[model samples]
Target: MDTVYSVVGLGKLGASMAAAIASRGFRVIGVDINRRAVEAVNAGQAPVQETGLEELIAANQKRLRATLDHHEAVLNSDVTFVVVPTPSDERGAFSLQYAAWAFRKIGYALKEKKGYHLVVLTSTVLPGSTRYGLLPILEKESGKRCGVDFGLCYSPEFIALGSVIRDFLNPDFTLIGEYDEKSGSLLESTYARILENNAPCYRMSFENAELAKIAVNTFVTMKITFANMLADLCERIPGGNIDAVTQALGADQRIGPKYLKGSLGYGGPCFPRDNIALSFFARAVDTAAELAETTDRINRALPAKIVEQLKPFFHKGATVAVLGLAYKPFSHVVEESQGIYLAKTLADIGFRVVGYDPLAAEPARIELRDQAVVLDSLEECLNQAEVVIIATPDPVFRRLTLADLQDRNVETVVDCWRILEKELKGHSIRYITIGQNINDEESQARLIKLWGNTDANSDT
Candidate 1:
């Protein structure tokens, strides 16, 4: 029989895993320190708004449950998946405190349990995380030999927050790096039921798995940086559209399109932090990655790029509304989000910045604080601003029509996602978007359609 699965941190990744495992017909326990998070899950609700997640939870509510007690979660489940946060400190150091605390909690709990238990780590950690960071602590806590008494692996999960549930249920591949054959076999058996396509499960030593996760993100970061570099050049050259260039480049079989869209740089919790953490880890071992540093430098300049984009319309005391503060569409997480940083830069440069997001208003308010004004409605945001920039292309926001913008009294629409340009071409409102050619006439037409159409409603 498959063992009961417990997810220790009911955040985005953990909640999705808990729900996915339950959907796969396994007994799943969702555990978190946050009371609200636990209650939401226990009530058959998702803590975050993910596509198809509520339905999945509703379908498998009987198999999945949430709790605050860590000991109960550990003792009840045979295999425990740890998906806790390991965010960096103020000084940009990867804080190991959270991971260590979770490890100790799990280790101590395992000591009180009778049967065989396997701990799977889905959190991203620096290389040697399993051997140097977690192994000794687990051994010390449990007072047991590593392979003989229990099983463990640093099986880092590859999931984007916006699409985590979908990615968890249907990943391109699965990497399970175990410290021992027992851990590998145990995790493999558990994954067999979930990974229905029998996705390639590469099993190796713990260090390799840790490095693989870093490599995956690092490569993606580099790809985005490359695209952004092209975008910078495209901005300077007449009739140079970075979107066109990327599309043409993606036509080649070698560079099949993915993560090529050039925007305000890569954001979210993982890419920036993981890239830097990987660099730190490498530097600690006297092997600094120059390419990694370059990638970091390129991404760090994206906020400044937004400032430059606004320089053309830098009227004295101009107020700009930044729509969509989340790193991506369909997610509320704004850790190291480019939109927030862009708003901060604009605000610092004497441009009054107002921010609005469908789901990330609270998080953006907290992250940006007094630096930016977070408005309630998109119309209120658009009405108070001179230039409105759409940073995230949330499907909800993407479907917005010219009538919506007109009703909202929007003046200038800057689309970072390259949407709404074609739809609002006849409008008199100025339309500026990323990687697109925008002449004054086009901008005026956009403005007319958006702001000048006072009497016309829903009539293009």
Candidate 2:
């Protein structure tokens, strides 16, 4: 028999997962507290804005539906995936408040259901959260034995906001934290059917899977931080180029580079918080995650450091244009965005700031209210500034021509991602690529002083 899937919490990740599963010919029912989200799904629309989500949901409307009732979703589907938000608390640990409520509802629903069902947690939480914190709620509320009566698994998806659907369908590997062999095998089989790729499944105990999820994200953040440090070093070296260095580094079999781009600091909902959370968890366990802690601190300090570097360029009330308010490119999610941080920091330092994003203008406006003027178009932002800073590697920013940046008032172009290096290098404006040496003469003198002159042969 085909597995009927139910997804709780119709947020970006949950809704996309539901739509993706239904796209694979599975009957998927989604449950959410938001009436609008439920209505949107039923009306053949995406509840949240994600790349290819609305189209996917609309195409798979026949197989996908949503409801507000947890009982209905739990009773109907063979497997239920809890994808509710596990927001971080004061201590940097993910709060289980939302997940606990969702679990309680599912527990009550399970009491009335006849056959065996599997409850899968797809939320990011600290280790022992699933087996110790959440499982007891299910057992107590439902009044049923876990392994004998039903099953549970902690299987968080490795996905980003913009490409959730594609990532879901084509994950590098599936991490399943199962209660037992029966539960793990059931989910593994379901994933084999649903996933587009022949992805390997790593099944283990619940706690191990929970740790692995955060560990993956935290480790990636460390790699990103390491690259950002290299960018800092490159700026001081003669003939330094981050791309050249990273390209060579990536060729090494040991360091197959994905996040080795020595540009701006990494920011988004996941990368920043995951590192801090790992540090918090380490301290809680009477150990230390000093590397994770340092990574987070360095990333957080990046905006201020960049502002200090550009301080000399700022005059009394000089207008600075910040392009790309979203963390990376595409989509309109600005949570923990480094672009927003730059704008805010510049504004606080008495520079007149104007910010622009292709999609995240409104959210950036809300975030930068009165701190910086969030403009609708990149052209408008460029027109109002003496200095332009490309904070994200958005394709729109890359498409900017020499004509667009040729304003007499504009004196500098700080290309954090080096997108406009070739086009703007010899332009009238003082072009500064973050990871490249700006003072060539000074750098050369320092190198010659350190290593002695290569031009003159030394007597042996």
Candidate 1 C-alpha lDDT tens digits along 1-460? 7679899998778888899989888999988889999888888889877777888888898999998888999999999999898887764556778888988988898788887889998888777877898888888998877788889988877888777887887787889889899999988877777765667788999988889988999999999888877876666555658889999998988887798987668888789976777778778889987888889987888888767866886577788888889988777888878888889999888889999998899989999899999998887887787777888887767887887777765677878877786787668777776766555465556667767858655676
What lDDT would candidate 1 get against the real structure?
Answer: 0.83
Which candidate has the top score in lDDT?
A: 2
Model 2 lowest lDDT segment of ten: 451-460
What Cα-based lDDT does every candidate model obtain? 0.83, 0.92
The most accurate candidate by TM-score is 2
Q: Please, what is the TM-score per model?
A: 0.88, 0.97
Task: Rate residue 172 of model 2 by lDDT.
Answer: 100
Q: How close is candidate 1 to the true structure, as a TM-score?
A: 0.88
